[model samples]
Target: MSEQSVTFRYRMSDRDVFYGGGVVNGARSITLANEAANRLMAKVFQNTGHCIEVRKVRLYEPCFAGDYMEFMARVRKMEGNRAVLEVRSFKIIEVPENPPYPSSIDVLPEPLLSTVVQFVYETY
Candidate 1:
């Protein structure tokens, strides 16, 4: 079978929030990203007698509260039972609210959040 790439997007919710008084934490994003990447790999390797494992993961951007985050994964290199997959996370910021200043303010990292995960798959 030929190697293929898969992508998946997940919206940020109270459960995915990390720090800034959110339910989730920075490390939570890592777990979410890893799970998503594994799911994508499973879809691509279905019926191919292969397994997937993450090798490396890096966080580039921070997803803030009330923002939509998207994840994209692609198969970069494949050699025998091993394959490298790259995953990126993007945050969609929402429009600011108007009117009086709020008592509490939530701060988060700027720009989009990105993560690259490598996986190794073996066929039986």
Candidate 2:
């Protein structure tokens, strides 16, 4: 790979669920993506690196308790001492529930969160 990357899966549990519903908190979803970003930043941090901020963070769907989330991060661009990475979280492993379609047998869908994060390496 030309750019450093990482992928991992998380099983959302009751602790991560939001109030009044099985809905996973948006903050938890962001953290999921951030974990991946941290990996990429470490790979490029020959200098003192820190995540400046995340930009264009978007969530398309509600992740719920018992959903298996897949997280991935890849460098979108690196210029000078700054690197931008794209992070995404997807609901992969689903379960049986009130079936419009059988959740147990349904195919995993697209990403639920898409975000771009900028990491800066301080040169002194």
Candidate number with greatest TM-score? 2
- Local accuracy of candidate 2 as per-residue lDDT tens digits, 18-123: 8676877888978877777777666655433666656667777677777887888887776665666778777776655675664353446654553333333232
Clashing pairs in 1: 18-24, 61-113
Q: Which ten residues in a row have the lowest lDDT in candidate 1?
A: 99-108
Candidate 1 Cα RMSD (Å): 5.1
TM-score, one value per model: 0.65, 0.75
Each model's total of backbone clashes = 2, 0
- After best superposition, candidate 2 residue 93: deviation in angstroms? 1.2
lDDT digits (tens) for residues 52-93 of candidate 1: 666776766555555556666666776876656666666645
Clashing pairs in 2: none
Q: What lDDT does candidate 2 reach at residue 94?
A: 63
| Regions of candidate 1 where Cα sits further than 4 Å from its true position | 1-3, 21-24, 47-53, 95-113
What does each candidate score in C-alpha RMSD? 5.1, 3.8
Worst 10 residues of 2 by lDDT: 115-124
Please identify model 2 stretches exceeding 4 Å from their true place.
Answer: 44-48, 98-124
Error of 1 at 96 (Å): 3.1
